[model samples]
Target: MSSNLTAHHYGITVADLDRAIEFYRDVLGLDVLDRFAVSGPAFADAVGVDGATGGFAHLDAGSARVELVEYEPEGDDADAGAVNRPGATHLGLAVEDVEAFHEGLPSDIETISDPRTTESGATILFVRDPEGNLIELIEA
Candidate 1:
């Protein structure tokens, strides 16, 4: 790894682009920067799949970008069963108030855990997105 490397964005594959966009944009308050429909061998090679085609949306999330992709006609619909397991991916979003943020979430969004204070006095909570992806809310 390069010593000067910095994270450009975090990519997530969602089953529904519109729903994910609503959750990340409208609900989470991220701004949609760009959207695209991708296909062909170059994308397949980049993603390490034999064939790749999808709906991609790049959203601005504070200092970082959230890349939401919906691989249509060939994407996997496997349910994310547990967040504790290895290789399970989750996003940690910083908020001003964890409790208030949790309370403001849509009714359809599921709460996985209540707010708990860390050793550093930061409040943290877990919630699941519309497609069952784990999201962590933190307030320092």
Candidate 2:
């Protein structure tokens, strides 16, 4: 029998590693799990890039994780237009309170959807990240 393919985290391609780290670590409250440069040829084969450079960091947000991929532009798989892709979708992360999250959202963020009470009583708000990635702030 095959083991279930668990989605451990969402991988994001970043133009700037340090800046992205600051955003996810400082701006957001995600805990940094590990930050270091990847080594060995296995990663290169896995990412389809031979010899990868730059730093990578993993952040733990709730049960899911966020992987920040920073490459030196040699043979990176990530394009700069991750959020701009035609069929790209946002990463929905649940928050304890939507109202707090809504209030926490930066003013510069273009609110996709305002906080609204769902029929189930939960509140939901949609907002875009600095990278223009859509995020659904769901409240329990």
Q: Give the winner by lDDT.
A: 1
lDDT of 2 at 1: 94
Per-residue lDDT of candidate 2, residues 37-70 (tens digit): 8756787777777676657899997777998877
lDDT of 2 at 128: 56
Point out the worst 10-residue segment of candidate 2 by lDDT.
Answer: 74-83
TM-score of 1: 0.90
What's the true lDDT of residue 28 in model 1? 88
Task: Please estimate how well model 2 matches the true structure, expressed as its whole-model Cα lDDT.
Answer: 0.74
lDDT per residue for candidate 1 within 81-136, as digits (tens), equals 78878889899899999998988888877887779998999999988888899888
- Candidate 1 — number of clashing residue pairs? 0
Q: Considering only N, C-alpha and C atoms within 3 Å, which residue pairs clash in candidate 2?
A: none
